[model samples]
Target: MTPPLLTLEGVELGVGGRRFCENLHWSVSPGECWGVLGPNGAGKSTLLHALAGLRPVEAGTIRLQGTPIETLSRRAVARSVGILFQDQEYPFPATVLETVRAGRYPHRPFWSGESAEDQRLALTALWETGLEGFDARRVESLSGGERRRMEAATLLVQSPRVWLLDEPTNHLDLGHQIALLELLLRKSRGQQGAMILVVHDINLAARFCDRFLFLFGSGESCQGTGEEMLQEALLTRLFRHPMRAAHFGEARCWMPL
Candidate 1:
């Protein structure tokens, strides 16, 4: 069997002399979409950061496509991976087009202007993200959903092989939430690349991801197919709720626990 595109082996992440989670082993294969489910303060964000090579690993190793993560330069890593956090702050004043254009930075030489190809890719990304109509709008004036899409557009322009997203549906309405989830599923499962998302909605994860990683507070993790793992009893235990799963046309929907 072919090995996974990304792997975390006995990983340990710490901050300010304290460890949040330790000894994590996870892998992501091509054409796979993995959803990370955990309660608040469960170090979900920390885990994402560690996987993206943004945080210092106290022990163990991270490899991207069999290459040690540390061996890649920051720019090279950025070119290969795109990450969207739950809360991203933009202090600079720039048009939405300009902001998305920033995504092309990793692909261009420093101090160089965007080429014709970069411009074409940027515009295509905007169209893919549903921001074509608002390309020239100020970033500070976009609605919550629009801003989220704008950030997604930026990442799309990166042409990354690996995607990391945190709480991607938080600001989206029901319709857009479904749309985004569908897009993610299509891309990850078809031809784009591997994707790992930190999602709090169990139902959404069940419907979209090929695999699920349940992160527990006890420093252990469980991963398997949605069908094999998203049982009512297991979910009840995982979330400390009376939740139940409902089957809906090749997907499992969540109801109150």
Candidate 2:
């Protein structure tokens, strides 16, 4: 079996006096895409933050490539793990290309400006995200969906081995949503790549993710393949509602009753 790229052992966290996750043991391996599923305030985003080392866990260890994440320098972590935040904000005025180019910060020295290779990578990422002609567009002038796609482009330029994405599809239309997820799925399956995304779309997760992790927001959680976690009873209990299952050919779907 292939080794894991990232591992979480005995991880626990809580927010606003509510305990959400406890004793979380999970691992992400190369070429694997894992879906983080939960209701609101279930610590899905919180867990991703912990994995990225941006937020501290209440307890437990997070390892990247078998090394304790805490021991790695911020630059080291940034070089290996790239996070796509749910909310995208551009505090300073810049063009779309300039913004995407910033994602290469970890690869170059602090005094170094954008390199030619970096520019090429940024352009390639923009084209892949369907933002080919957006190079000169002002960041603030773009719509929310366009900005989200731009963020995806930035992550591509970052070129990290592991991706931690929070609501990667927010503000996207149906076609754009599918396109972005397909792109992300491709990235996660690329060379030595892994991904874990916090998403509210159950069908999208089921379609794209081979592995599933469910957080109950009561310090209880579960993880497994889709076949083990996609049952009506599990999802019904998970969402605190009655869920009816359907099949579109061999694809399983769920609807709240």
Candidate 3:
């Protein structure tokens, strides 16, 4: 069996001193896309933050590629894991190139600018995300979907072994959503890396993810292949809705409640 690329044991997090989740344990293997499902306030985003080392772990261990996340330096972590948060706030007026260039900060110093190799990487990422021609465009002027793709491109430039995406489908149109998910799957599969996405859309999650994790009050109750785990009873209980599932071609899609 392949060792897990990332593992969380007894992990816990909180906000305003309130525990979000406790005693959480999960493992993700290379080339697997794991969708995290939970109701509002279930700490899905918090879990991603913990994996990315953006927030300190209060209780347990997060090991990335066999090393304890806590022991890794911030720069080392940045180099090993790339995160696309739900909220990507860019306060400065930066062009698309500039914004994506920031992804290289871990490798480049603040005083110096990007080198030729860095520009090549940034452009390669932008090209992959379909923003190749918009290098000079201001990030603020792009549509929500475009911005999301750009953010994805930025993370790609980091070339991490594990990609942490928080609600990546948010605000995207149907076409863009499908396109982005497909692109991510293709890229991660090629790299033999892992992608852990925090998603609320059950149908989308079912369609894209190879495996799924369902979170309840405090921690995940189940995780397995989508076909094995996305049962009607589980969906209804997880979302508190009378939901159903149907086979569409080779995939399972969640029916409207």
Model 3: per-residue Cα lDDT over 89-132, one tens digit each: 77768899988878888887658878988899999999988898
Question: What TM-scores do the predictions have?
Answer: 0.92, 0.97, 0.92
**Model 3 ranges with Cα > 4 A deviation:** 109-112, 249-251
Which regions of candidate 1 deviate over 4 angstroms?
16-20, 188-192, 248-251
For model 1, how does the per-residue alpha-carbon lDDT over 80-143 read when each residue is reduced to its tens digit? 7888888987798889888888899999998899998888888987888788878789999998
Candidate models: Cα lDDT each: 0.81, 0.90, 0.84
lDDT of 2 by residue, 27-98 (tens): 899988899999898989888888888988888999999998999999999999999998966798999999
In model 2, the number of clashes is: 0
Clashes of each: 2, 0, 0
Arranged by lDDT with the best first, the candidates are: 2, 3, 1
User: Judged by lDDT, which candidate is best?
Assistant: 2
Candidate 2 global TM-score:
0.97
